[model samples]
Target: MRIIGLLLLTGSLTMGLAACGGGDEQSTAKQEKAVETSTEAKAGVEEFTITAKNWNFSSDKEIVVKKGEKVKLNLVNKEGLHTIKNDELGIDLTADKPAEFMADKTGEYVLKCSTVCGATQDHEGMEISLKVVD
Candidate 1:
């Protein structure tokens, strides 16, 4: 019957729309989980190891910590030479040694590669987010 064929087509369309609608809800849930995880990061002397190669950072996860905590960063450069620097936090680390800085304030800070290791670029692929929460 004509009505049966039309009903089947309508059902298929409705199922497709439901699948699309679920995508947004899943994304929102992921965002919330990230928030919870960031807040629950281990406090006091947070140690992080970063691999520096291919002109990019190996770890893109945001460095989250409470204010007034110490951030201990260990850098390893497998490709070329590199250093990490954040002007706001006065963190300048060379490949020769590790870096430790105080998360003095509660705000968002950007860390970048200050050393000129890459080609024709002031900042290589080393920009990452640093968040200090109260």
Candidate 2:
């Protein structure tokens, strides 16, 4: 019984010592690096607000963006779940929270709601034209 008690006391002390070591310094350094990287990546983005209702998009109904510019497309849903997809940019954004995409090409791309909803916005076929100018 005395040997068992000694072993338990030693094990507890070893674990306590390990927990008090400087592992938190490494964790804090990594977190700071990640925040810096994210800030730099979003430094020069041109932001826009897009509102999605039951079957349509409001506030900048059609997008006219400049090519080679980083666009931050912010989407707000007020009615239901909506999806905006652009085939050229390979974007399929869901309207749950805010979202963003880059405008890098100079041409016309078809934008539309990919959500299958009720009999509004032309029966779930609401569309928008995105024209990127050089």
Q: What is the C-alpha lDDT of each candidate?
A: 0.71, 0.67
Top-TM-score structure, candidate number: 1
Q: Can you list the residue pairs that collide in candidate 2?
A: none
Q: Report the lDDT tens digits of candidate 1 across residue range 1-134.
A: 99999999999999999888866458545644543454357455676666667568665355788998888766656666778898788888665576788888999877788887757563455666778999
Candidate 1 clash figure, as a count: 0
Q: In model 2, which runs have C-alpha deviations exceeding 4 angstroms?
A: 1-43, 60-62, 97-99
lDDT of 2 at 14: 99
| Error of model 2, residue 87, in angstroms | 1.6
lDDT of 2: 0.67
Model 1 regions lying over 4 Å from their true place: 1-43, 121-124
Per-candidate TM vs. native?
0.59, 0.57
